[model samples]
Target: MELISSAERNRLFESFKQDAFHLELRDDYSVPDEESPFTSWTRGESVDYSFMESWTQLIRSATSEGKTVRRVRVITEPHTPYIQWEHETTGINDEAGEDIRWLPRHRLPEGITFPMQGNDWWLYDDKLLAVGHFDDEGRVLGSEVITAPDVVAECVRVRDLLWGLAIPHGEYQP
Candidate 1:
């Protein structure tokens, strides 16, 4: 696959705004060192704060106008509250009719990381944000990436369920 430049990536970012829903895949959703500055930090994780701010504002508008946006995260533990906020703030519907599935990281055969291993992906829709790990199996392992649409559907289903279980930030814990 041909690599796209930062400018092209930015354009992809812009496309997210135009679409009613969007998806993203990242190593982790939150900015690293969120707990404390004292924590060790990664090398050169430059982020787009301004762009993220703009996106937040769009969320505000969307919520006020009652347009739903789904934010999904496929993580091992401590799922972010922003996901709940994103759902409640977006005023998403409870019964969004999406599928849900979970396959553990350990389930992933050993020896996989970002570049060498396939990266996970996120899918956002009017009612859900779905995340899936990407991978290519070694001759002795499972497939590298999720190429099947049925598995994708299951991931979406899982997102819908978790979204329902998640409560609005600070108000109540579901």
Candidate 2:
């Protein structure tokens, strides 16, 4: 409902979840995605680690006021070495150790397909990109959507590259 500013984006990152505020970067700068999946396919803008932490903090804050959080969907090029590098660097993929959740594009229902990938078309869910902002016992609060187009593009493009790398259902890639 409200568009957050760069300053606010920064603050949220520093004082919040280490991965709280993420931004999107695109591989194809010439094309700005009109069908931003923030509305359809995936959730939240990609952010630097600082912003990511702040996002986590904001979710906790909402819960302090009585809310619950359960899921967050991140769209990324499943093949990006950066994905693994970041998780490995930030310790976000520690299984029973950290808070990061990795969902390859193929895992979600109808999440991946052809023509879409070959033409560099990939869609993600914005609804899924949010935290619960729940109650102490896990009830429900509101939602947080990352609407910044730049961040969205970054995420989408990165995921596109990864899609290229991903071993498809029929072992397809073109």
lDDT of 2 at 77: 54
By summed lDDT, which 10 consecutive residues of candidate 2 come out lowest?
23-32
Cα lDDT of model 2 by residue, 77-140, tens digit: 5545433334333332222122333445444445533221222211223211222133343323
lDDT per residue as tens, model 1, 1-174: 333332333233332432232232232334332323112223233432333444455455554555454543333333345333333323223233222222223333365333222333344332222223333321111112333566556555544554554434334332
Clashes of each: 10, 41
- Most lDDT-accurate candidate: 1
**Candidate 2 Cα lDDT to native:** 0.34
Q: Give the distance in Å from residue 98's predicted Cα in candidate 1 to where it truly belongs.
A: 19
The lDDT per prediction is 0.35, 0.34
**Residue 25 lDDT (model 2):** 25
| Candidate with maximal TM-score | 1
